[model samples]
Target: SLGQFAISENGGIALAQISNHYLGNFGMIILALIVIIACLKTTVGLMSAFSETFVELFPKKEYRFYLLIVSILPCIFANIGLTKIIELSVPVLMFLYPLALILILLALLSPLFKHSRLVYQITTAFTLLAAIIDGLNALPASLHTITFISVIINFAKDFLPFFSLGMGWILPSVLGFIIGCLCQITITVYKNKKSSTLS
Candidate 1:
């Protein structure tokens, strides 16, 4: 049973424990091999993408240099252990996930909005603000005691709808989108009127 496996800071241990219990040493070996292959493929893909992007952005830097930096940094950071890595990543993931979701939503609704950059920018700006607050809230408990962060968290909880449920960004994002659509309509109308007057 899953409950029989001891819990640890590294959640992956449970899977290993389960496999080992069910199938003995061979199962553990196979699981480890699978994990290694998975990690290797992911690392390679990420490194290649990062290196290519950096090379384009900074043409002076060679791809090899970027690859080396990415490789070395992760190697160094990996020494911190899985628990620490997860702890550091949680807040960052919290911050990015909402912005990513909002961008995807905007893309899907682009036809209705005529793919207006103004609409995307305004909505993204609002979502970014809320995402920042959520990220701060997700920070380590020790950091929560900081006066400014605590104040911000308290303020969000008091006013932002669904904040306690971690969906506070929803209302603001909707409002921004509506406002963006209105601005786009008003600008389009003004442009048409000016063109008509000139003709």
Candidate 2:
């Protein structure tokens, strides 16, 4: 139990190594961005392709074309990329109440054990501890900002209807997937056929 809680010297060294690996090559960031963009394109292409094939195997959705358009944003959550995006265009997300509620449900249910309060409690506790520690540790040198202001972005908005689930990187991707399925079927079929005939 003690060992489980202890932060080993080896662990610290490994973490430092990992950090260095990430922050080391300046050119690697560009290479990685290129690779990430390539992979996302491949992923979407494959998904659209497989979806096309699967319809022959199984039943197809009525609204597949509209949904694909909503999922155009490239899937990336690296802090480096995110900071760049924030500097470029910090989206003020506003949605209709129904859409907002749907996003909330998509986030909360999340394919995990549905309605499991214990799991939620444990997850929340871990999240809270990490967030609070980040706040405290980042406070000393950046001592100008008081603790009160730090609390807003720190706390969870699990109960709030119109909430920003900032801790998650996957949610936007998943939401994109869902909204894709909901909106983009007809156009996708035409484009799929046109491209298929050419290929």
Candidate 3:
């Protein structure tokens, strides 16, 4: 079924093909409806949130204006074809994934770290640098040919572990967290010693 369709052309084509093959016309219709309904709700929610946030951030712009812009941009981009949109989004997603993962980890370990701002800042700073490198590495081969990008990629390949496997951010994030913890401890000790000496 999927063999008949070019799945690479559109992300949904393969899903549609599979549904049509196993359950015929009815399955296709159901799948279409499900996708439409899911997308509709998601779009509405995102647009509302985006417009509201922008309106607050830039009070000169009205909510409706922001909403209109957000709505129009997606429509224009959608015309570019799903494959192209996905190609553009991959690097962005790669850049964000590590940052998001680090945040989640920090939240989970907040109790142990005593919710120290230093830990969060240091860890995120290190992770951000590595994530940027990862995103650059994920860029198209043509972009990778650019001198600076190629140099960065080569440096990461030489010095960063698991970079080839796309797990390059792991070591940096851990090291940052450890360094942050040490800094926090040192600060606390210094403050305590200073207070004792003063007393």
Candidate 4:
């Protein structure tokens, strides 16, 4: 159990190598099959998700057209080359990932906030600032030939706790939540006073 849990991120590749050590050529077959199945499942999931979102966002568009658009874009990117696509996409994905995670976390915990729009907006706005910096920092040094991103990252690193560990949004998110709660309390008090006066 300990060994299984201790496996690092490259554990699958390590496992495949071990299998090859024990099973020889047959292990390669097993590894290939596993990878192909995993890739196919992921491809299907991504295609379905993108197609559904595209159709829903532009309801007037036919599903076939949306699907084709989804399909062709990947094909074009693939043809342009996978490595190039990844190079261009890494910063974007990095930028988007934090926002996605924060949004999902906020949505899940929204009930705790009584679904307050002020809380949601404030928290998300703060998170957006951190996420943008994180995304730009995700870009390679070659792309950052300009000093601006480096300067922002330096400032964030100095002031934002956990910025080094990719959790820079945590502090801002908490601050936002606190401010939002205060706002809610103030609004509630004002409303109560107005109601009592009217009575």
Best by lDDT: 3
Model 4, residue pairs in steric clash: none
Write down the TM-score for model 1: 0.92
Superposed by TM-score, candidate 2 places the C-alpha of residue 28 at a distance from the truth, in angstroms, of: 12
Which tens-of-lDDT digit does each residue in 1-199 have in candidate 2?
2333445344433444444456666545655676579788887777677667655565655336423533443443334354355433323222122234444654677554444444344444433433443334233334426566445434434322223433332343344444444334444678899999999
By TM-score, how accurate is candidate 4? 0.79
Q: Which TM-score value belongs to model 3?
A: 0.91
- Give the TM-score of each candidate: 0.92, 0.23, 0.91, 0.79
Q: Cα RMSD (Å) between model 1 and the true structure?
A: 1.7
Q: Report, for every candidate in turn, its global Cα lDDT versus the true structure.
A: 0.91, 0.45, 0.93, 0.80
Ranking by lDDT: 3, 1, 4, 2
The residue pairs that clash in candidate 3, if any, are none
Off by over 4 Å in 2: 1-38, 45-62, 65-68, 71-83, 86-120, 132-147, 150-199
Candidate 1 has its poorest 10 consecutive residues by lDDT at 1-10
* Clash counts for the predictions, in order: 0, 11, 0, 0
